[model samples]
Target: MTIAEHRTDTTHPLDPMTTAEVDAVREVLTRDGLLGEHVRFAYLGLREPGKRAVETFTGRADLDRRFLAILLDLGTGASRSVIVSTTRNTIDSTVDIDPATEGQPPIIDTEFELIEDILNADERWTAALAKRGLDPATVRAVPLSAGHYDEPGESGKRIVRSLGFQQFHEKDLPWAHPVDGLVAYVDLTGRRVTRIIDHHEYPVPQEQGNFDDPAFTGPARTTLKPIEISQPEGPSFTVEGSVVRWENWRLRLGFNEREGLTLHQLSFHDRPLLYRASIAEMVVPYADPSPVRFWQNYFDCGEYMFARYANSLELGCDCLGEIHYLDATVADDLGQPRTIRNAICMHEEDYGVLWKHTDLFSGTRETRRQRRLVISFFTTIGNYDYGFYWYLYLDGTIQLETKATGVTFTSAYPGADGAGFDYATEVAPGLGAPLHQHLFCARLDMTVDGDRNAVDEVEPERVPVGPGNPHGNAFRSRRIRLTSESVAGRLADNRAGRTWHILNPDKHNRFGQPVSYVLSPEGQPPLLADESSSIHARATFATKHLWVTRYAEEERYPAGDLVNQNPGGAGLPAWIAADRDIDGEDIVLWHSFGLTHVPRPEDWPVMPVDRAGFTLRPFGFFDRNPTLDVPSGGNGGHCAD
Candidate 1:
């Protein structure tokens, strides 16, 4: 049949089919019956007899056209069927097939009408979609490990307790306490807690006085024989009260709080005498104008004065140790005559208690009196490890004396009026400062108990010269004096006496070139009117042993021989080398001694105590090894020498 005729028959009023139904049926018949092609079909709609009919037709149709049919039926009896033909190329697959019943009219093409109806419908479908979106079935959950819940508390506390802890408390612990995670306790007694167990890598107990222990206690005591001397034959002197004088001999008194008393003098003695005459005088002021106190004061003051004078001379370096030859004949480890000026010595001294005063008054008129104690001592300096030996005597009246042996280099200024100046300022051009000078002689004399004449009558005894004594050096016997009229004359003759010349033709001077000559003169000599014949005199001879030459190459030289032959050139003892380099650079070493009683609270503004003499000597005088680059040991290693 023609398509228009088929549409009319199917769409007839009595046929119970609408216009859409007729159109759908006609299209399906044309595409499947008129043409051969494969197609699939299904049915979807509301539950009812109308839906059932549509599904049946869709399944039973084995035609080439695919019919996806949908049925809509309200429970109110009115129903519709839509047959969609897949063979048709249209925007929608729906074709309504419902007929009018009662007051409702048939829907012809309901596709657009159904869409509008859905837009006007209530929000049930939208709400249903939202509910489905939120359902738990949309996402999967991950399971946690079983080990996480195994413990009841924090992990750190469990570890600490696992180690070796019993009971613990968080209170009364330092902010940086070892066991910040856990605080362990030990024992307690009153305000003082006994102990605590720290959870640190290396735990230690906290206590007072754990590391402090005395290494020594009190003052060490020792003794030496009193030094006495016989008088010279020229003049005889006697002590009148505290004054002693004869010809050029003179004596005086001096005082110190620590040493209590002292006696000083200018005296003469024969060369055979082995001991020097040093007398002490003291005057102990009276608590009640007592004579005994007066004499005691004189004795104490005299002793202190004498000791100080002696100590000053004892610790000096005499120029009898070592001398270096800088000539071309010498070769060093670097195969060159070493060109460097350097000197060193290690010496020691002993200080002894002259007297000690344990009872002195303190406090003002309005305050209670306090007792103060005072101590005085004598000291001497000499070589070898820079010795310092001391003795203590505390029974009001005590005597002490010290003797030392070592080299003493005499400065150009050796008399009472002598003074030192900068080498550059004191020396003339074309001549260098003196090195390797020998100290020939040093002397001091004093009186005790206000005995001035005693110094003149008492002669200094000549001490026995030993094998290593400075006085025994052959070159140390020369003596030179500086005088105005003969200044130039003394300078020329003293060149060999006071100067060191560089003889190596290839050796570099301090300015870095070959050195031709060098010299150093003693200071200006005293005028005749200013000279004191009996005063203390220290004479130094310019010796050849103390000179060192700087070279441009590295070579080993006979250093031992150069030092051995020069006066004052003996190297310091081995033990002194422990903390110093004796072969390196030029340096000067100095040391001094002093005495004071044990401290007491009453002595708030402490009085100056008696200070002994001092001396300086070259210790380590050079740069360390220059050829090697040594690495430092982080924080722990032997300290630099």
Candidate 2:
């Protein structure tokens, strides 16, 4: 019967066995040993289940009268076996005939019935497999490997041949030695080479100086080695014939006498002249020599200035109470028949103070009034030189921002770990902390020109001004609150000691006025005796006067806290404080200026050439000393371990 018909016939139920049934199976299978041979049964229906049954029986089967005829297949011995099926029925059988003498006979009715009975016990079969530590569902079929055949039609023949012989064809061998001296072997399936074995005797090339064997004993050509230069230890040039030329361009007096005329190499300290002039012209309607006052007044003040002179040899102005100007003069010195075609202006309040009278020709009301000054100077002693200075004066105290362009040092903020820890928690428990110290420090030297007889030690005090005051009811005055202890004291006490002089403005120049003062010889003192107070409070004070407490917390006209509550407003402009959100993720601290106090002549072509810069610093405004232990890059080895 065909495999399909056999599967159908074997599925039928059979009657209980009788003596005749047993004898009929015995007579057909006892006479000839049908067991002890590896056999396969193919099914047309339920192929997988049938195959599983065949695998479990380990024998061949065929359909019989009312049951399946099965052969006992131990291959090597005459043995008894059982078959079970999915229905929990079991069939047991024994082949009594000897295969040594009589050839194997066809399976009989009795054997078929017995096999069918066993296979019907599906549960028993499952239990038997489970007992034997096998999971029927998880069982996999392992394919047998046969040698390759030259023709597709010869595959069966090749398998037959491969089964009879122990060795295979060279191409079908499953293992090979590569022509490139590598050994390759196929897996058991004989499909492809699974692995390659390398047996070369020499080692592969490797990068030199791996981590395990780090050696720095080469010629040192790859690294940069410092070069030492020792010039004859003496003055390089004699000062002979060196006429001190006051270079007007660079606001400095150069010693070189190359050009007969004295030249001033204008440095940052000299920039105030330009800044003041520009600001003045910007404020006063008749301030500029050009007859554009009526036109300028129509447009936004700063825009008008920029449109008129941003690029031209004129001055530009801003809203800040300051002035800036540019002038080209044939006259040699500052005070001469100079065509000082410059501009001047001021903020409304400052303008009122400088020019109180309504009359245009009236001289300034107060010559000694505080003024915000910005200056730029350019000169050429030998090469191009420029300088600029920004001055803010209030209540007889002045703070100068000086910059010497081109002659400045560049620096970077310290890495994360250097700044000190946040102390906000220590102070206010939950509120944020103030920065322990400033990330940058600048040094400046200034010369003041005022009433030589004016008392330098005026002991400035907070005075009131308003409607009832003598100055008229335009502005109100508030008491100035200068903290008894300043950042100067704290910096002096820090380990950096005298080197921290940059933060102590008092040590650099006394209140923007020429005075004798130095950093306290002793180190800084403790900022606060008690840590419970707000660290911010300990660092910054609320004030009104520009010289004392000009910083505000909010944009509310007169009285408010400082923006971000940062000490010293963290150098941010009061107007910027109004905006809650800015595009950049971090707050930036910017400071720029010119350096040197000298002015020269070469800077005249573009007189008052100045350098201006800004810095973007991390504003962990609420963080502790951000640069506490940061080592200064060069010459800072003194603190290194």
Q: Quick one: best lDDT, which candidate?
A: 2
Q: Best candidate per TM-score, number?
A: 2
Q: What local distance difference test score does each model get? A: 0.21, 0.21
Per-model TM against the reference:
0.14, 0.16
Model 1 ranges with Cα > 4 A deviation:
1-241, 244-250, 256-265, 269-480, 484-641
Model 1 earns a TM-score of 0.14
What's the TM for model 2?
0.16
Residue 542 CA displacement from its true place in model 1, Å: 19
lDDT of 1 by residue, 441-481 (tens): 11112111111110000112344568756685333423222
The number of clashing residue pairs in model 1 is 91
